[model samples]
Target chain A: MKIRESSALILPPYFFLTVFFILPVLIILILSFTHNRDWSQGITLKNYLLILDPLYLKVLIRSLIFAVLATLGSLLIGLPMAYYISFSNPKRKILLTLLVLVPFWTNFLVRIFAWFTILGRQGLINSFLLWSGIINEPLQLLHTSGAVVLGLVYGEIPFMILPIIAAMDRMDISLLEAATNLGANRFMVFKKLVLPLASPGIIAGSIFVFIPALGSFVVPDILGGRDSFMIGNTIKNQFMTVRDWSFGSSLSIILMVLVLLGVSAYLRQGRDQSMTLGEYL
Target chain B: MSHRDATSNVGFGQGKSVSIVTISGLVFLYLPIFILIVYSFNDSRFSASWNGFSFKWYKIMWHDGPLWTAIKNTLIIATANTLVSTFLGTLAALALSRHRYRFMGVYHKILHMPIVIPDVVQAVSLLMLFAFFHFTLGLVSVILAHASFSISFVALVVMAKLSNLDRRLEEAAMDLGANRFQVLTQVILPNIWPGILAGGLLAFTLSIDDFVITFFTSGVGSTTLPLKIYSMIKFGITPEINAISTVLVLFSTLAVSSIHLFDREKK
Candidate 1:
């Protein structure tokens, strides 16, 4: 309880975070404005300017598109499931929730790798179709935009489901019965009552899905072709392969700014209401 | 009444559709994982074909030196990261939850920042930081990077538990002539031990599963399971990966289920 004691408690984590986490981010932010890979050269706007080029701009746009689509895909699949789980009996509710979350426990790269096996030319779908005599040749299911989107959506679906289910669990069911009694149709009850109440979860879920999907390198890297390049891939390339630290740092800063903006909006919205990590999990 | 009939009809229809969606959603979630697990036992070297079930891949994995080394590195990093982060995080959580301070708001924001930032950004930043300091990228760097994000997770979990804790118990301990350290060790810690355990497990899970940050920070001879798996997958899919994935998935499932069951019991 003493100030000195508390400070002692806090100082270790604070120092660790400052050195490993905070300083690195600060370095990147500084590096972003510089022209040279290392800090020896003078600072310039060239990195930011380079981002404005049509090629990089297009990759950024594609990243946004993939994220938005993945968010929508997960919502479409996850919302109804969450709704069902919310209304289920307690035993069934726990079982169903666990079932939904089990895949999420698997390693992320392994899950993406599973998709490679499922969508590859000689993979599951192709094998099934070929056995059924529906096609003579294997379809090009892998290394396409669809493959990338599927990977993103599959990877992020649990994030969507968990929060939405939490929201639905907190919802007042009596309102639904009352709406039904007041002559509202099922669709009307859902649209006017349920959807509005679950909006917080939906928003939270969307943020969870969208942010990761936007910045994902693994999904695109393993599942996508050259044409499916995303901003994450470009940034990784800039740093690792090209060894252009300044450009990589610039791209990263831009992505971070965008993500922080989204997070700030979410925080502002979340301020009015209380949600717990238990529910989010 | 006709109204009753109509409502029942709607309920029946909704039930039917909900069941359909729920069943299909479960299938969608589990199908890929199930397939991957199943193929791990396939005799075929290529994962795509069913060359009859055998444990050859698993056997190969057992004898694989590099695979074992990677697993060793992963376990080492995960264990070290878990212990260090959990300790640091518990302290931070205690500080934030137990007392109000001048810089609490700023400290809270700082804690949450790492959680929100994408892994790629975090990875590159840490990588750059190491470069700046001329620190070699290796297990130590990986541990530091993982602990950075993991501390936040541990703090969040522990703080949630801390906030829900009944403060009267601590007050009673104090009133009973128990000193701060005595109350902390005997009363406070005993109560929050579950949270700390859960936080530690969660940190362990995240640390082991982490690829992006580890990928960036790992130097030669520091290939963790994920980095190793990534390289294998890039080279091409092999049943060896399937075997590895299966084991990891099973371990993770056990870890996560225990976390859930622990929390459920507490509730």
Candidate 2:
């Protein structure tokens, strides 16, 4: 009776996940290696090797450049915002926090489209400049790398802010006082006391921003000109236009590997920082 | 007294830091969005400048069929995804929290992977997986894809509530000869129902806002609102897009905030 009841409790979710989620993922993994170009060629390593080519390497570098810039931008902006909210009056904190999240509730595509109105040549910024007698022609702000980064940082700022706020809220306020009492100046207190304490939050926020930015498709596709194609756009094109599922699978596997490496490296650095700090202090 | 003194010193400089930070943060966060909203009303046909405010774009948005269809489809998918994910997610949470899970570590990690995995990769992987299995991209694929991610989020949030719950009440009920089902329904459900509701609302919002996964899994005819907006933006910008976006932003803010308001009301 006990055994029967136990199984019944676990059965539904387990069965649901296994059938719909696990099986599909496993099927994709299995098909990734099979070289069924003509449905009879069987399994091979050609797809994997194809991914290691110079062309893909360039694409991989391009994605890293975009993601890194966006992550840095989010950090520069999000850190201070998080600090404000974390240190603010408890009553007003909730309202400010809601500001970060409210934008996220709207569809991402709509938000990106909104950027079009602002950044496009005939859009607001250029028009404002033209009207102000600054320039006779509209500035070519749209369909550029800058626009791609702007869209990415805009979309991901909340993701970066939330984690940093969580970290900041948990910080030991006494440490800041200790640093100040020890004759540390304001900049010294921030650099030595607050930055170290917030490293974990920064790390977490960076991961949250970096990973998504790396694989973001819509921003790059819409805002980026032909020169701004990331690996994400490549994979998207493969399946949608090239009609090549196998090649897309290979790209997915490579992206997964790169993401894992990046995350692991980030965690390692975080771990090392804490370890060295522990040793020094 | 020592702790209080230390806290006061830290609090002293915090105000100046906060005011400076708040203004900068607001500019960083809202400048782009503000530019977009202002340009939506511009009379100028091509640029982001304030040519003049007009309701012409709003009228155009009303006449657009694709936009309406996308919104309708997104609503349907969000509703369906919420219901299905909430049911499965709540059950998963219950199983994790109420029982001593054996493979708990593995289960938790697997569920969290969707959130951690880049959406672009997941999009491609799902598309490849669907094609491999000969599953066609349509409403069904998108629904399943959304539910898969939503379940994890729902489970995580519900689990947070469950962990904070006192087990003594459930233990007492069980000790009084109540069956497990009766105890779960009468004892646990009422206490955790608020969190479950909040989780369900979040799932709905996520489903509605999702674009990347839906973009890949949705067939040509089954355009969700985000996908429709994506296609439209590639060609050109219009005022109707702005009007639709303004309405979308307002609706989502109301939807998400209401969940928090409801939660606060209980407390």
Candidate 3:
């Protein structure tokens, strides 16, 4: 009786996901191997082969590089802040954590757009420099690889911070004291004790930041120049502008596989921590 | 506990530099938003320059018909998606948490797939599905797509809550002659109400803020706020966009903060 009741309860979402979510992805997998203009031409490796060209390969490499840099940038900025918050009093901890989340609450597009006014040729930074007589000409700050990295790092830092803070909250502080009492300096203590203990958080946070950065379209679209085009841009163009669904589907599949690898790493780390999937998010 | 204090003191000794990093991190996070809000009141049309204070952009946004249409569409979709996904997800969570069954592990993994998949992949696949099925790309398709991904999130939240639930309450209610339906409605539902509410708010926020999936699934007339903003930003930055974005930012902040506060209170 209990089993039947449970099945009844689960059936709705099971059916919903199978129909709308799982089935769609399966269709995309099938579609990627077929001809774009005419499906009747049957399955072929053309779409996947096309993605192997050096031009497309460069975009894929650029995406990976950008994602790695963004992940590292977020870690550099987030670790200290999360460390501070972890040691804060309860009242201050909540407040500081909320501060981290405030930017995330804003529309992602708006946050990226804010960079435009700050980085454009005639924008805030340039105008201020020119007014202070620091430079005779407005520097090109927008539409560059550096600008894209900055935007991505800014956008993803909170994800990195939150998990690290959660991990730190659960840490055994006595281990830190033992390290200190044994005459290990702060840097040595962090390297030997804190860093090893927080590896799970670091891995989880990296997956969170890196996967999104890899698949990000809007950030690059807004802040990146032509030379900074990532695989996401290539995929977007394939679908929207080029009107090649087969090629787009193939690109999407490749990206999905990469994301799944990151997610599996996250899941493994999560298993060690006994964390629910929701907690990782 | 004394050892903990000793370690925390070590942390406190570095407080000066830590505070600097924290303060600067806060500034980095908010500077763009602060600039955007301040520049929304500028009399200039271009966002980069500030002539003087004015509410011209606000007035312009007030009269922007397409913007209003997008807002309406977004709210309608978000509301519908939230209601449907939350209901379905809560049911699934109850099933997963309250009962043990064969293939339960596989079921859990399947449910988590949507949460991990990239939005672009999900978007393109949904677009393909719609084309394959001859489903018109419109408000309905967008709502379906949003709900499809959002159900997983809702289930996850509710499952987390349900896992910690005291099953004794339901058993006690049943011992007091309550039927299964009454035990569920009176005992389980009230217990998990906060999770349901949080999941609903999350779904609504995600549906409202969704861009990638909506971009592909939305038809010519069913643009959402994010979609509208994307098209506008693609052209160029304007004070009008700043004003609209300020409103969106304010709304989302309120929504997300309320969820945070709600969860805190439950804890």
Candidate 4:
């Protein structure tokens, strides 16, 4: 009887998700195999072959480099930020955590756009430099590949910080005390105990930063110049401008596969096999 | 051990160096937004050098008819999306936590599928689906795209709330001879009401701020505020865009502060 009632409750989401998410994903997958939406011509490997071409391949490789750099930068910066909070007084911890989270709650595009003032040719750094006699000409800060990486790291730091903080909060404080008492020095305790214990969070944080950075287009499009085009731009161009739906679908499938790999790794690392929103906040 | 000595011995907090790094990280996160807000009021149009403060940009934004239309469309989409997603998402949370069903694990995976994939890919897929069905590109399509993505988020928040919920209240209500439905509606639902609200608020925020998915699914003449902001960008950096961003940041701060207050009051 309880099952009967519960099934009724479950039916809406199942139906809703089926029509909107699952079916759309299936359509795209099927669409990828067609010859530029001319399915009557039968399935072909043309789209996949197009993606493998060197001109497109450069974009894929460039995106990977940017993502990897952004992930590493986030980890380097976010680790210390998380450690400070995890080890702080209870009252201060809440305030500190909120400082990290405030940026996250705002508009993502606005955050990227915020950098425009600081990185534009006539922007902050350039104006300051000129006034101080540091440079005769305005330095080109915006519209560069480095600016894209900066936007990504800045955007993704909250994701990296919160998870590591959660992990550190969950850690056994006594283990660190025991190690110190057993003649392990400060460095040894961090290396042997705190760092190892925080490894799961580090992995989770890396996955969080890497996946979005990998698929990003807005930051690149806004901050980067023409040469800095990523795979996302390529896909968007194909679907919207070129109207090559088959090629775009194939690209989407590849990106989907890469993201799924990250999700599988996250699931494997997390003992609960799920990430809850409460923990993120 | 003294508090200072204990922290130092643990070696995680090297005190000054760690403090500096943490402060710098916070500054890096905040500095851009701060500059953006300040620049919103700058009188000069071209030079990055500030002239003086003015309300010119805000005034310009006020008279922009298209901006008003976008705001109307955005509010409608976000409000409706929140209602539908929160309802479906709360049911999903209840289903996962309270009841046993066949293929529950598979259903759990299905719920998370939207969240794990890239938004750009999700947008492309939905665009294809809508195009295949000859569905008109407009407000309705945008709502579907946003809701499909926002549902998992709502479900996750409510599930977190459920995990921390006490089941004995429901059992005691039943012991007092209340029907099962009464136990649920009276006991379980009331206890998790804050969680439901939190989920709703989150869904609303996601729908409002979403860009990538909305970019694809939205038809011509249909625009959200984020879409409006992007269109503003193509014309170059203006004080008007900064003004809009400042407003968005302030609004989000207000929303987030209320959530914290509500959560604290509940406790």
Candidate 5:
């Protein structure tokens, strides 16, 4: 009786998602294979094959590289912060976490724009360098790969930190105490106890950061120079600038497939191994 | 439990470690915001110097008509999206909670696709769909796109609250001759008001801050605040941009703090 009642409530959300979201994505998959312009022109593999050119291929590889780096950077910063917050007093925890989330709450463009003012040639960093006589010329901080990475790491760290903090909060303090009592030193305790407990959060955060980082167009567009084009920028340009919807759709499909495969592999490994590191990002 | 270390070391060492870690974490999280706020009032264009405080930017931004239009559009979209999504999501949550299905796992997973899939992909797909259907790119498309994701989030939050809800109360209402609709409105909703409010606020924030999806779905003459900011950045930096950002940040801060206070009071 309860089960029947529950399904009735679930039905609306399911129906909406199926019709609006699932249908569109599935249509995209089908569209990528069909004719470019006219739907009536029928099926063709040319769109899929078209994205395999070296130019598109290069963007794909670059995006992967950036995603990997971004995931690792966020993880490194987020994991330590999560660990620290985990051991903090409960009273201070929420307040401290808010600091992480406040930036996320603000308009995303505003935050990125703030970076331009800080990093642009005539911006703060350059002004400081010029004043201090550190160099005769202002350092070129803007429109660089470094800036792109910095922007991404700045943007995504909150996402990484929050999940890990949630996972860490769920951890039992007694486990760490037990490890310490069992002749495990601090380093050993962290390695054997804390790290394992934090793995799920870290893994989840990594996936979250990695997937979006790979597909982000804004950061690279604003911060990256000519040579810094990522796959997202390419896809965006194709649709918006190049007016090549078919090619863009194909590129997006490939990206989706790659991300799906990567996540599946991670999850498969997760199921195979008893991951202690899952809880902390 | 203190076998070796004396009383002096027990709490102090751990406390010190935690303090250092916490301080460092706060620095990581808050330093950027601190810088942003500090620069907001600077007379100098750069953040490097302690430029004299000036409100010029605020004045300029206040006068910008396009920015005002963007804000209006944003409010319209956010409010409409929040209402529709919240209503639909609450209905779905109630249905899911009160009924059982053969494909529960599959159902839940599909609903969560919007959260997991990259935003860019979703934006492109939606653009293609809407464009193909000959839908205008203005208010209608943006609301539809925003509602799609908002519903998922709202459903998830409300469903969680629903799961923890005591069904006995609803049963008692029914036993007292109340119908399903009456019990839902009078009993279930009041109990889960917090969750519903929380979800609604989230949807509002997300819709206002959405850039990529809104960018794709947004038609001509429907410029939102984020789009305005994009245009501003594309042109050049201005004090007006800072002013607008400050206002946005302030609103966000107020919203977030109120929610926190509410949660605390409940606790």
Candidate 6:
């Protein structure tokens, strides 16, 4: 009786996901192999072969580099930020964590655009530098690869910080007490005990930041110059500008595969931790 | 790495260097937003540089017809997205938390697919889907696109909340001669009310802030705020965009504060 009832409850979402999510993705998979939108030309590897061009290969490499840079930058900042909040007094911890999270609630376009107030030619940094006679010309900062990485880091750092804090919260004070009681110094306790305990969050954080950075479109489109094109820009241009639906679908498939690879790695890591870290970004 | 002994106070690495990194790290996160908000009131039209304060941009953004149309479109879509996803997600959450079934493991993995996949991938796939069916690229399509991703998130969050629920309450209610429907409606529903709200709020936010999906799914006359803002920014940065951005940032702050307050009150 209960089984039947549970089936009834699950049916709505199951049907919804089937029609909207699963079916759509599957349709695209078949569409990727075809010559045109209607598939009148039949299945072909022509679309996939087109992806082998050196130019497309270079875009993939550039995309990986950007993703790696942003992930590393986030880790460097998130670790200390997480530690400071984790170690604070209970009263202050909540407020401190809140500060780290407020930016996330904003639309990402707004967050990325905020950099304009600081990085644009007539913006804060240049204005200050020009006033002080530090440089005769305003530096070109906005339309550069560096700015894209910077935006990616600034855009997604909160995802990295929050997970590490969760891991830190899971740390038992008794473990620290036991380690110190066993003749370990403070640094030793931190290096051996705290760091190891925080590994899961660090892994989760890396996956969280890395996946989005890998597929980043807006940051590059807005902040990056022509030379800084990532795979996302290529995929978008294919569909939106080039009107090449077949190639766009194939490119989308490849990007999805790459993202799925990262997710599988994350899921493997998550086995020990389970679904606690599964909050969708 | 220097000034190590400074961590001796409270012993959680409250070192001078740690404090510097942490505080500066926070400044990195917040200072751009601080500047963005400040620039919204600037008198200058094109440059971000201050030319004293004014509300001229706010006046312009207020009267901007296209901007209002986008905002209205966003509201309609977000509301529809939230309502449908929350209902379906709440049911799925209850099913996952309260029952065991065949192929549950596979079901769980598939559920995570929408969550883990990049937005661009999801967006293009849905575009293909709608195109294949000759579906009109408009508000309905955008709502479907947003809800596809939001449903998984809503399920996950509500599932998290449902995990801690006491099954005994439902059982006891059933033992009192109540039917399964009565037990669920009277007992299980109240217990997971917060989860539903959180999931609904989350769905609303995801729909509102979404750009990639909306970018693909929306057609003429179906622009959302993010898409409108994107078109504006591409042209150039103006105090008008800054005003719109400031309002967005303010919404974020309000959301964070309310969540904080709600959490405290519940506790």
TM-score of chain A of each: 0.94, 0.86, 0.93, 0.93, 0.88, 0.93
lDDT of 6 by residue, B1-267 (tens): 123223335477565666788999988988888888888898988574468989999999989999999999999999999999999888887887777778888778777888878888888888988987999999999998898988888889888877677877777888899987888799988888988898899999999999999999999889999999999999866789889988887778888988989989998
Q: How close is every model to the real structure, measured as TM-score?
A: 0.94, 0.90, 0.94, 0.94, 0.90, 0.95
Query: Per-model C-alpha lDDT, please?
Result: 0.86, 0.76, 0.85, 0.86, 0.77, 0.85
DockQ, structure candidate 2:
0.44
Docking class of 2: acceptable
User: Once model 1 is optimally superposed onto the true structure by TM-score, how far is the C-alpha of residue A166 displaced, in angstroms?
Assistant: 1.3
Worst 10 residues of 1 chain B by lDDT: B1-10
Residue B209, model 1: lDDT of 88
Residue B18, model 4: lDDT of 74
Q: Runs in model 4 with CA error above 4 Å?
A: A1-5, A182-185, A270-278, B1-14, B172-177
Sort every candidate by DockQ, greatest first: 3, 4, 6, 1, 2, 5
The Cα error of candidate 4 at residue B50, in Å, is 1.8
> Evaluated with DockQ, which candidate comes out highest?
3
Q: State interface RMSD in Å for all models.
A: 4.3, 5.8, 2.5, 2.9, 4.8, 3.8
For candidate 4, what's the TM-score of chain A, rounded to 2 decimals? 0.93
- RMSD to truth, every model: 3.5, 4.5, 2.4, 2.6, 3.9, 3.3
User: Which DockQ values do the candidates obtain, in the order shown?
Assistant: 0.48, 0.44, 0.60, 0.57, 0.42, 0.52
* Per-residue lDDT of model 4, residues A71-100, tens digit only: 999998999888888888655777887787
Which ten contiguous residues of candidate 4 chain A have the minimum total lDDT? Answer: A272-281
Where model 1 places Cα greater than 4 Å from the true spot, the runs are A1-5, A38-40, A274-281, B1-14, B263-267
- The per-residue C-alpha lDDT of model 1 at residue A22 equals 87
User: Which is the better candidate, 4 or 6, if ranked by DockQ?
Assistant: 4
Q: Per-residue CA lDDT of candidate 1, range B4-79, in tens?
A: 2233333521466767987898888888888888888889887656799898999988999998999999999999
Model 1 residue A129 CA deviation (Å) reads 2.9
